[model samples]
Target: MTAICIKCGAKKSFPYNKCGECAFDPQLAREDLVKSVCLSSGRYGSQFEKEKYDDELNSYSAQLRSGLSVEYDQEEIERLDMQLTEVEELDDKPIFKYLLRVFLPGILLLLFLIGVLVVLKWR
Candidate 1:
C-alpha cells in the first residue's frame, strides 16, 4: 500500500520500502528523522556552530508541532524537546566544566585506590 511518508511527504510503498526522497523507512519515519537530526547535532562545536544547530533544532521542533505533515507523535515530540534541552545545556557549559564532570570521578577513584594500595604495601 502506498502512503504519504510522514517525514518527507513522499508517496511510496508504505512500511516496505524506504522513502526515495529522505531515505527514511515508512514504518519508522519519525524515529529515523529524529535520530538523524539529533546525531547530526553533536555535543561539541564552536559557539557559532552550536547556535546554528540550536536554530536548526528549533526549526525542526516547530515543524513537528505545526502539524504540517501527518499527525505528530507525542513521544517523538517529547524526545526532541529533551534533546533540545540537553543540547542547550551542553552548549552553556564550559569545556573545563564538562571535562571535570566527566573525568573527575574516575580520577578521584584512582587516587583512593592508590592510597589504599600504598597503605597495604607498607603494612
Candidate 2:
C-alpha cells in the first residue's frame, strides 16, 4: 500500500524508498546530514572556525531532536539521553506541600463519634 504524508497530504510511494520531491521527512534526512558534518568537523581552518562549525552543528542536532519528537515517551527520552553529551535530568518530586486539605479530618471525626456511641451502648 502507498503511504501518504500526513502533514502535507501528499501521495507518496515507497517502491524505491522515497518521493521524488520535497523529501517529505526532514527528520530522516537530518540524520544523514549530521553524519557527513561530523566527518568534516576537524577540516576547518582556524580554531574559531572549528568552534563555529561545532556550535552550529550542535544547534542543528538539537533542532533535529526537538523537531522529531512528535510524542512524549519516557523510554525514548532515557534512550536518547544515554548517548547525548548534554541533557539536564529533570526533578520528579512534587512541588506542592501536602496539607491535609480534604476529607481526612471529617473521616476521623466520624470515627470518633462512632467510637463514643459504641462506648455509650456498652455502658
Candidate 3:
C-alpha cells in the first residue's frame, strides 16, 4: 500500500512518510509538530494556517487512536497533547457572549418592569 506524503502530494510507501523529493524525516516532523502546538496564534503565518496545523494534529491523533500503522515518538505526542490542551483552555469564550446572551436580556426585562410600574403609579 501507499500513503500520500504530508508535505507533498506524492504517493509513497506507507509508514515511511514523505517522498524522495520532500526528504522528510520522522524526527524533524515530530519536532515541527511540537513547535506548531507550542506557538501562539499566527505562528504558522495566518489564522488559517494555524487552524490547518491544529487540524493536522487532530487527524494524526485520531489515526493513532484508530490503530493506524503510522508511528510517531510517544514523548512528542504527549507534549503535543499537553500543548493542545493549554491552547484550548486559553481560547475561552469572549466576555461579549455573556453580555449579549445573559446580561442584555436581564437588563431589558428589568427596564420593561420599571416602565409597567411607572404606568401603574400614574394611574
- For 33-104, candidate 1 gives per-residue lDDT tens digits of 444433233432476766665555555545544565444556755777577668767886888798999999
Task: Report the backbone clash tally of model 1.
Answer: 0
Candidate 3 vs. true structure, TM-score: 0.26
The residue pairs in collision within model 2 are none
How do the residues 1-123 of candidate 3 rate in per-residue lDDT, one tens digit apiece?
A: 323444433334442343465675433655544533332222345667666655555565456445563455567557666765687567775666766897888899999999999999999
By lDDT, is 1 or 2 better? 1
Please identify model 2 stretches exceeding 4 Å from their true place.
Answer: 1-99
Q: Over the stretch 9-122, how does candidate 2's per-residue lDDT look in tens digits? A: 234442123433445452355342222223223334487776665555454434444444222244534444343323222222222222343666887999999999999999
Per-model lDDT: 0.56, 0.42, 0.53
Off by over 4 Å in 1: 1-68, 95-123
Worst 10 residues of 1 by lDDT: 35-44
* CA shift of 6, model 2, Å: 22
Winner on TM-score between 2 and 3 is: 3
Arrange candidates by TM-score, descending.
Answer: 3, 1, 2
CA RMSD of all predictions: 14.1, 14.1, 12.4
Q: Which model scores highest in lDDT?
A: 1
